[model samples]
Target: RPLLKTALLGREIVYIASIDSTNNETKKLAAAGCVEGTILLTEEQHGGRGRLSRGWFSPFGKGIWLSVVLRPRFLPQEAPKCTLMTAVAVVKAIRKVTGIPCGIKWPNDILYQGKKLVGILTEMNAEMDAINHVVIGIGINVNIASEELPPDLAALATSLQIETGQPVSRRELLTVVLYELEQAYALVNTQGFDPILEQWRQLSVTLGQKVDVIGLNNRFSGVAVDIDRDGALLVDTPAGQERVIAGDVSIRPA
Candidate 1:
């Protein structure tokens, strides 16, 4: 059956049994000028990585490990919207597939009760004004069992089966996610990023919370008040308000 009902996404799916990283593979294809919405999926990713180069645990056929290639007309400065939009798409898919309400943590991590459920990595290659290609890497913990998770990640990660008390279909979840992504992707690139930003705020777990952000050369603790127009995190700190473009955010003890 054709699981995808979208005009753009999954138009050409490169499925592999195993790979080092779907994002890496997709990036190569993108560099060679793969069409927009070319999806590179793998049953298992041996060297999957998340934001900040953190290892993503993808074992065998238990999860959805994939990356989509997009050649959007967005300027380099507007690249942050891709991560925000992708997070919303995954959140919508999780709600429909498992009926579990998951929240997005700042830039791109999807979590439920502080446990990570999905991670989105949006990487782009571009000139100063225009983007060459954007590879959105999405890793969803779908059918991995509770006890089967690695000891290091057991406390901090979760799967759909663990939340729903039954096995959820990865194919179905992936289909819905891709469909939602295509919609959000088009909307953000066409209409504007504000609409998707509003949806991101609604499902945001980082907002209205005391948090700490670690950037490349700065770190600060503050209250996450809101997001800016370009999807930067606006934090209210003791010094003043800080606009964080890319950082590692953790909820601080209140």
Candidate 2:
């Protein structure tokens, strides 16, 4: 709590040495009517998972594995914007700490040099008209040594140590991330998602690129053009423009 002096987020924390997943933990807390800004932070996640339930490479003391609980008054349909809000916050925090300019993939994947640096997953417990609470999970590869990562993951993932050739202080990075998120959340509550959406578009690497989006039941190819207010991708396909909410997106040859 001393390291993180944020006003809105991280006021209440549940720090665990090891856990299945921070998101799952936060969900339980959120269900029990925990404080709105409570955070679930784990040093290690033995069963961490990402957007498509793919196992996340979260070795102990190498990355940031955490989830934030929010009780926003927004409708259920507006929950997805929180993911967008988090992506911009983390990107800004990373740049401030490491001086590395990273870009955000569609929805909320942070990438550097075409390899994944961070991933965000958001879950909500809401009714049709209102939201009960939300748990947004964020995983960042901070000081993970390259060799410690699995062979399959090392090829497609990176860390702050590998990007900068030196170790990073996870504490400092996590503090900055929470501060940024608090500020962004306050902005969204005061104004709207317009400003954040504009910032997301500016920091987006996927926009204006030819990409393939594979959903649960459909696959399509298109040029990534824009994102909606709710952070859905707006793609111009051969048939027509399609609104993609959640999918496995891969940028292809333009």
Q: What is the TM-score of each candidate against the true structure?
A: 0.96, 0.96
Per-candidate RMSD, Å: 1.5, 1.5
| Candidate 1 whole-model C-alpha lDDT, 0 to 1 | 0.88
Clashes of each: 0, 0
The superposed Cα distance between candidate 1 and the true structure at residue 124, in angstroms, equals 0.5
Q: After superposition, how far is residue 162 of candidate 1 from its true place, in Å?
A: 0.5
Q: Runs in model 1 with CA error above 4 Å?
A: 247-254
Q: Candidate 2 on 73-155: residue-level lDDT in tens?
A: 88898888989999999999999999989989877689998889999998989977999998999999998888888899877
Candidate 2 local accuracy as lDDT? Answer: 0.88
C-alpha root-mean-square deviation, candidate 2: 1.5
Report the error of model 2 at residue 227, Å.
0.4
| lDDT score at residue 115, model 1, on the 0-100 scale | 94
**Model 1 residue 230 lDDT score:** 84
**Residue 247, model 1, lDDT:** 42
